[model samples]
Target: MTTDDPATDRTDREDFPDWLRQLERDIRPGPAVRLRIWCRRRSRRLMGAVGVLLVLALVAGAAAYGSGHLRRPGPAAHPAAGPAATASPTAAPGPFAGTPAAGWPAGAAGIVLPAAHRTGDFSTAQVSAGLAQVRAALLTARLDRAFMAGRSPDPLLRHFAPAARASVRKEYATETIATYATRLAPDARLAPDPPRVSGRITYQATRDNDGARKLAVTTNFVWVYGFRDPGARSGYSVVLLHDTVVWHLPYPDDVAAASRGLWLHRTSSYGWGLDCGTIHQGLVRPGGLDPAAAPFPEDPEALYDPDHPIAVPTHC
Candidate 1:
């Protein structure tokens, strides 16, 4: 049962215990058993690969959805119920919404005065006072409801120097009042809301041809009026008036009391959306509202822009 020689000491099948030998023989796999084992390993690896592919597909789908490349089906649209269900394709915008005056301040508020500062030889206080007087004049000429309604123009003329007031009044009576103030036509009625105003006022000290020192104040403004037009496209018609008024303030002691106040120096104005046929009457009549009104050429963009030089009014 034992050997002492080194070569003979090697283990043999006989050295295995009975139980171990029996177990080895009983557990030996045949062809079918080997095949089953191979199939199980292959199936596990295939399942793992399939799971990886499924995860990849889910990630790709999520990315596509985030990028807006994937669109999901939505519920079908239902038909509208009423005969007027369809909306107007080219309907006009709401009152003033489509025009440049949409954001402008209403009434006299839009005549913005520049901060008073010493310019040339004028003092800060004098500049401030001059600006105030100019503001009052603008409000009376453009925004005064009574004046626009065809009242006496004395209120506006009162602001002018006594010597200049007579000439201005003479012009007011003989020439079209349209140049000096907005006067509505006998048949025209403005909307209850105040007219919209926009523009700026500036002042500087300058000399006349005779070298007399004077503070020159200039105002550039656009006044937009909405007249009641129930039959018009937007339920109202628009009239745009642009005016530039210049006033000269002489030193207190330079002249007599009667000529001491602000003097109307020069003025230029242009208006759009007025009936050319009746405008010569010195009253405002909205053009588009009347079928018989004559149509004149105008650049609407230029009308709304304050910096654009006034275009000569076209007469039909």
Candidate 2:
């Protein structure tokens, strides 16, 4: 027993030294040092994450600011602040401005030619007198060379306004009367009778700024010519032609209905033919010619009537 006791005591003492050394090492702070190192590493990682989040927040704020500025309202947002709020400029009165007085018609028809055959202020008889002067002028040109030698002496020529006179002068000056006569057949010559004429004249009665009456007339004529050239071996030849004349008078309504009638029907294309009838139906209506009345017919085969010869000399 004594021998075994001694062996056990020695073994126990040896084990105790190793165990004490291990305990001392554990309590010395090595565990605490490892834990402190781990905490420092984790703190650095968290700080890095916070820094990234702050950078993202700054970028997002800049984008939002730019977007807001771009969406601002423009000048059109307030209409009252725009050009619409300004007053519009007015236009000046025209030459023919102002409403006509009471009882005056709306257009020229009422102001120029009120009645079917009457003009402004002038009686039908007075208009006829003026028109007779025009017819005389036309007839004189055919019958007498002296009348055609210079400007027409008829009072009707004086009635024309300056513009109308200029126009007539220009037209007549440029016209080749010699050429026109030469185009006729060698046997052609002036007829013995005057041309039969018919038609209407339209006149304008406008007052100028100085209160002077101004007149503008349009005449249409249907002329029938009976050729009486002695050289014609085929007997008497007849032809028809049309003419239109426009003139101005110093006074209003100084044109006659008969003259106007003669002017309108004077042109061969518009006189005593189907075309003339068509024009009459269209032009002479409620305000023009009597629609109920029949138009004069034209015989396609007949050249002229023995009783009603209307031809005049063309050459001097």
Candidate 3:
């Protein structure tokens, strides 16, 4: 007792407060050990919460990426809905608009002319009216005076080649009905009773050449002049001339070889009328002549000297 042993005395000491003693007894090892265990439990709970938040963030990111990829235009894409979806304005009317009359003339099938013909056989009255209209249109600018006068005017001058229009205008200051007649080659006649006033005209036209191929075509036209009044004078005349113009279809080889020199001729009540005459000639290249030309005037009044040949290219 007189000599205290430090280790044993410390272990057996009871000098601390009752609360401290109780606390020490409550902890299994020491206060520091208890603090370390509490801290580890808290750290595990915090880590679990952080993991849950990270998982939620990843899921949200994936959904956002998928949504953007699906919503992303090109040829394969559907066309946008707009005014372009409507039908074109120039489409032809239905078949009900005009039907061929029953019991059409012999050699005439429906409103269309048949292929092949006898020597005496010629175009029907319907076809003739169409030709007349075409002639008048071609001669419009060239026969203003003749139109004003009461004479049957030449129709070619009005519908000359678009290129020749300027030249004709320059040469013939004022187109006269007499000038129109002058341009004709003498033998031409109007078909007595042209086809009916309404409906399309179709015909099988063959070329003048022996080996020429025939073709079928339908044409529609508007006539600016009507049947002239025998007694009345001074009125704007108008009529509807619709018919088919069937002409021989040139063979591919002939068309290729002949270039612009090919043309078709027809005999009319008035005179010999040449068609496809105004076509330009030259190589098939830039600045070349067009293969389809205007009809040449055979009337003496409208004729150009062959020897001197009008400056206009009349190769055909």
TM-score leader: 1
- Quote each prediction's TM-score: 0.65, 0.31, 0.23
Q: What is the per-residue lDDT of model 1 for residues 248-313, given as tens digits with 9 covering 90 to 100?
A: 987665667787777878877888788765667667878843455455455465688888686564
RMSD list, candidates in order: 11.3, 26.0, 20.5
- Clashing residue pairs in candidate 1, if any? none
List model 3 lDDT by residue over 184-206, tens digit each: 21222212222222223344544
Candidate 1 local Cα displacement, residue 271, angstroms: 0.9
lDDT scores of the candidates, listed in order: 0.76, 0.39, 0.33
Name the best candidate (by lDDT): 1
The CA lDDT at 139 in model 2 is: 49
The parts of candidate 3 lying over 4 Å away from their true place are 1-39, 73-316
